[model samples]
Target: MISELIANAVVHGSAGLDEPIFLWFEGSSECLRIEVRDSSAEPPTVRPVEPEDESGRGLWLINELALTWGHGPRDDGPGKRVWVSIAPAHMGLL
Candidate 1:
């Protein structure tokens, strides 16, 4: 889950930017939120994937694993944040 979110930030959001990706975590044993922020203004999207495609499944995987997921423009900079929420059990923390 962390890899997918970071990869999305690097592949889809950090296209030629000098800024580093910002990672954040919040919540408790019941639930946790992971946020990946990158220096691109473009939003992330989940497009249709075919059976033979080798990629384009990161967001799909995130959707399947996360309790909830979303992305939006950064509140403090010229970038965006893609985030996911998941149960602690999924993280083996419970």
Candidate 2:
């Protein structure tokens, strides 16, 4: 899940191909959160689309499957962080 989102941000969010993208993951007993950072300050426009359309839709899937998701300013960068949180399966008992 994190891989897909990070890749999408790299491919779509950066102002240029050379711009850097960052990925972060944190986990807790009840949930897992993933953040993808890019050099663009604009928030990503994630929307639903037909599965066969074949041009967009990654973020839509992320929002659907994750428990909660959003974006915010980076701690010390000019860009923003797009994030998603998912409830840990099996209640983290495993």
Candidate 3:
């Protein structure tokens, strides 16, 4: 999940240049929240998958597995933050 978020930020949020992005994690023993911030304000979408498609499933996977997920404008800057929450059981941390 973390990898998917980061990769999406790199692939979708950046404009082919080496740009900075932000990642955040917050929570306690029961649940964890993850956020990825990038320079693009566009929110991610779960694209329709073709049976033979080899990729484009990142958001779809997040949607299916995350307890909750969403995005909003970044508080500190331009672009946006994509976030997800998962229970400890989901990560085997319980």
User: Any residue pairs clashing in model 3, and if so which?
Assistant: none
* Model 3 TM-score relative to the real fold: 0.90
The lDDT per prediction is: 0.88, 0.80, 0.90
Q: Candidate 1 has which clashing residue pairs, if any?
A: none
Number of the top-ranking candidate, with lDDT as the measure: 3
lDDT of 2 by residue, 17-69 (tens): 88889888898877888888988888877776886797677777776688788
**Per-residue lDDT over 1-94 for candidate 1, one digit per residue giving the tens place of the 0 to 100 score:** 8999998888888858677999999988689899999989898888889999999999988878788999998997888989999997875666
lDDT of 3 by residue, 27-53 (tens): 997888999999898889999888899
TM for every model, in the order presented, reads 0.87, 0.82, 0.90
- Model 2, residue 80: distance off in Å is 1.0
Q: Model 1 segments beyond 4 Å from truth?
A: 89-94
